[model samples]
Target: MKDSTQGTSPGPGTPLPDSILIVGGGVFGLSTALALAARHSGKITLVESSPTIPNPHGSSIDTSRIVRADYAKAAYATLAESALEKWRNTDWGREGRYTQSGLVLVSSGDQFGKDYVRESYENVKAINPDAVEALPTRRDVERAAPGYGSGLHVSGGYVNWGSGWADAEASVAFARKKVEETGRVNFRTGDVKRVISEDTGSAAAAARRKVTGVELADNTIITADLVILATGAWTGRLVDLRGRAEATGQALAYIRISDEEQAKLANMPTVLNLSTGMFIIPPRNNLLKIARHAYGYRNPQRVPSPADSGSNPTQTRETTIEVSLPEKDVPIPQEGEDACRVALKEMLPAFADRPFVKTRVCWYTDTPKGDFIITHHPQYNGLFLATGGSGHGFKFLPVLGDKVVDAIQGRLVPELQKLWAWPESPPAAAPPPPSSSSPDTVVWTEDGSRSGPKGMILMDELAKGGWKRSSSKL
Candidate 1:
């Protein structure tokens, strides 16, 4: 019953609270808030600037593709294995959840494309040797889909039964529904200006300078014992807590397909074009979603409010839905679409004339490396950093939430550390933890001391941005 929305410090040995505040309400944010709600019971509250789950300018809600367990990294494989099960089991009956449509990799023979085939094939083979196989020739691929007979070129790489898609928007709605019923969370429509931390000193200050609460853009202040800033693309907007703003931008698109073509390719599975750096996903209600593998697009740092989308009720949902092609200055590129059309035509050529129906965009928050950044701020003891998802975070949202929970609890997560640690930039040459003499515990300085690792070499790789942490309130 503490004003769970407002901040108040714990005095002396007085027990600190279990109540928490969750910011943002997107898929990851909602899922994290709901998972933490289930984990901590009625001890969480969610603050959202939008009235609903899918922010119009946000990522598409219709996608159902999940990369599954064929990931190259051991951590990713294990996490995907668990997430696949959760998606299958309905994880407590959340609708528009996971469906195993499997994933297909297509290539016309470029270095990156070949690399994708090799990597995906290697990963799949290591796990289930029989899961991946190469198609013999273009004729064989054409046999798989009537359309591919002429237009599609086949390098023939694919992972069967491992990858799939999910209803992203529905997933968000489901998670929100689950957490909404908890009665501990109240979804208020207000923008978060900053996450204010309490001031505390010394080791005993564990209960001291932790996140006190958040301030809304309206000037109304809300506080809590703990705060989780899960806002997506706008994550850095929360606070400048010791260099946590490190956010990047990314974008995604959806291609329009004919109703008949959509149905034909509906079962076509998620296909990655290694050569073109494009991916085609079969989404809900019959649509093919296309996106690029790289990031660094023209998406701005801040998304406009609902009003900016001309999203007024009279404006209509169709009016709010918008799309932008890969190159900002150029006209929407038809080359990617042409590639997809040709490939799909080869696979099932019934509709070469069918043009891309619609398009939309979304962002990815990236770290210096493509890995996630989930840790505590060294200087700001109370705040935990959970941004930097790059592009691959969606498939691992649940596990990521669990890791965030571990960080909030202040316990070292061994498995998580491998993925989250900035090994190259060990925490600034500050005094070592009390017990450990050697600073073997790697840390990254905001000044770029710990940017990457040995295996994770830098390639001037595109920095795509992506969001959310969790809470403990009802």
Candidate 2:
């Protein structure tokens, strides 16, 4: 996690564009802005559609998100370990923003969760063997957290005391404040309509054409030599990520617990059952949160083909393409609610039937392998993509931006470069269900971390509630 530009002059490479514009202001956008302003003296402008930095509708605005270096892949595990050190010792995690509540990653059946957790355990064990304890059975899990209700589904897992959860909204706000304090980045609020571009040569040249700027929803134009799309779930709408990324809505629900109940479960570590993709974080302020990390619901919409959106009319005909985009302020579908209920029944039986105080469908910019797309666009020149959090990017906020800046400057370590590069031939997206015509571009994250059914439509599932569901925990 060394700052690549901290010591030396700019390396020999194409000079960075004098003016840089960033779209979207979630973890990726703000963090990238923070790093750029810190290391570069160029003009940096960050444009977010929302009036504020932490858009309430954004996925990163949740109450809590797991912050751990226990990743199945050695690369992410290594990178997350560096980020963890910052969270533990730096001001980035000050003021109640981070809590070392510990994490219990478990799995019951012979699904991918078993292998994933095993791989993750070995990885974390390497980082800090002293902080990681292996749980060999359901009883071991119970002993670690006596507060859990009986009949837990965990067969085996591990507890990493060094891991914790981050106050997502607070951390994001901290990033914004830091970026503002730099007094280097200019902030703007605008709804970007499309990337402003023109055909430089023949029709074939459209793929390599450079975007001079972006056009806003209000017909306002913000010109820049470079445009970085940090847009999260909405990224598919702005770029032709036909097979690279899509938006998936994960379910999250909160229950209000009495002071007594909160006290009873005070310091219990977060429990995650990868076999079922359900997780329950200990209560804070008498509020308990239950969520899933599965192949979430989709809300696909048709939009003008991004490749041709701002190109010459004659060079390319205006055509529509379907991309899974975020549907905001939406309630969890009945399917998701049922899953949450099951998870509650197993984790905290006392509150199994309690009504949820609030529920939300958190959106993620998912990639096929659950990798973040942090490299330059393969077809579009002068454009870079920093989206594709794939449900795990928030933990890297402390150092992710510096890594992104490194990538932009052509000096990122070789390992991350390979992980974030555009797929040469991305796997064909899983086809839509027979009954529906989902966006052919919809890519359900097939990373071993995901569980539950795939290709579920949000509206369709909402309309068909009360269906039979697995009575086990979420």
Candidate 3:
């Protein structure tokens, strides 16, 4: 990992606090820590619940994540554009951590008129005309991808040649290493229990709530002038976000293929089928990944059982934690599996019969709307938030830290200040469950009634059966 701080130093004006503590070691936490360490003459300490920077169960911990500028909204498109530039020129770029295989956006409806795909293409083209190639007809798509002509409908979309993917886990590790080498960052292993605040009395309380530091689960308090909560899915568990965000568990699966098969499918760009919310990433180490990008299932908040009393029980009789215990594992829901089958059959028929090599449920800290929450706590003076990835944040790995720095320094433009502020009202609740008769149309629900898709089984169960592929065709 290259030291991004070598050529840069903090500006003479507006020096940040001398000591900062950042919780969570995922993309947001590591990136922000690196950014601050480069510019501020401060001591930065990053804490991770897990022993590693890129926790195995982290949402950002995966073989690959799509890095594209094809977003319906211009803000994300602009951010992605800047991030891509850095990815291609930075140390990670030089190390082959980012693969520039391009991305293909697919839509089911007529691609000519106004729609998500059309808007995305227009946005990217406006940013860089030569960055995308419009595939206006099926022939054009077929020429680009031969096997996609079967069940996939490529009405009107473009290939973002400037976009690609990043080795997610590797990127995290590399950034951590670079930050540590600077001799300014201290990385520690600990689970943050809650943010610590001090009362400023009734009169001063109206001014600003004073945040002291944070308390760890092991009963240790690490005090700092400023504390940033970058804990992705677990953000809600620590702070009273007022329904601004929730932890959602999305489905992801990997399919194994032979080297020959990998070579044959090497040219297939990362496919994001907007209609079905299914995305198929290109092969990495002979494994193709498929994931769902729609409204994922909410983890059930758990309450401690009252029947048992032990000195070191996992859960206390009065205490409760959210679902997805650190050791708990979940499988791909039937809905996700069906979506992948439908997508592969239509877009990449060659992978329809490939055996599933691995399956796991990845969690995302989703906001009511897609925008991120990177603002200071309205009530806590020394507390800030760098969360709300919304499942699409990893793509901004290169430039996101800079924005976080801007937020911390009170230099954000009016537009961004308003965009990243806490929501005025709580987001609407999840939609009602679909009729049981319409199994395919039903979405995941918070209640156990629709815990998972019909006939959903754990990966452990499938592993016992050798994880075989079904012979039936889509």
Backbone collisions counted per model: 40, 1, 2
lDDT for each residue of candidate 3 in 206-287, tens digit (9 for 90 to 100): 4456677888889999999999989887776666443566666677888988899788776677877665567777777888
TM accuracy, model 1 = 0.70
What are the RMSDs of all candidates, in order?
A: 13.1, 4.4, 7.8
Q: Can you give the lDDT of residue 380 in candidate 1?
A: 47
Off by over 4 Å in 3: 1-14, 110-114, 147-149, 202-208, 302-328, 434-474
Model 1 error, position 434 (Å): 48
The best-first sequence of candidates by lDDT reads 2, 3, 1
What is the descending TM-score order?
2, 3, 1
Candidates 1 and 3, the one with greater TM-score? 3
Question: On residues 1-474, what C-alpha lDDT tens digit does candidate 2 reach at each position?
Answer: 233223223464456779999998999999899989977888999999999879878889988899998889888887887888899999977897888889999998676689999999998898789999999988999887678867578798999999888889999999999999999999999899998876668677735677788999999999888889999999877777777888899999999999999988768898999999999987788889999999998877788887653223334656788888888776788888899999988988888999999999999999999999888876666788898999999999988998888888887777688788888765786677787666566688877899898788876786676422232121
lDDT of 2: 0.84
Report the lDDT of model 1 for residue 288.
58
CA displacement after TM-score superposition, residue 118 of candidate 1 (Å): 2.7
Taking all chains together, each candidate's TM-score versus the true structure is 0.70, 0.93, 0.83
Candidate 3 clashing pairs, residues 3+ apart or interchain: 151-346, 152-346
List clashing residue pairs in candidate 2: 343-474
Error of 1 at 449 (Å): 25
Q: lDDT at 115 for candidate 2?
A: 90
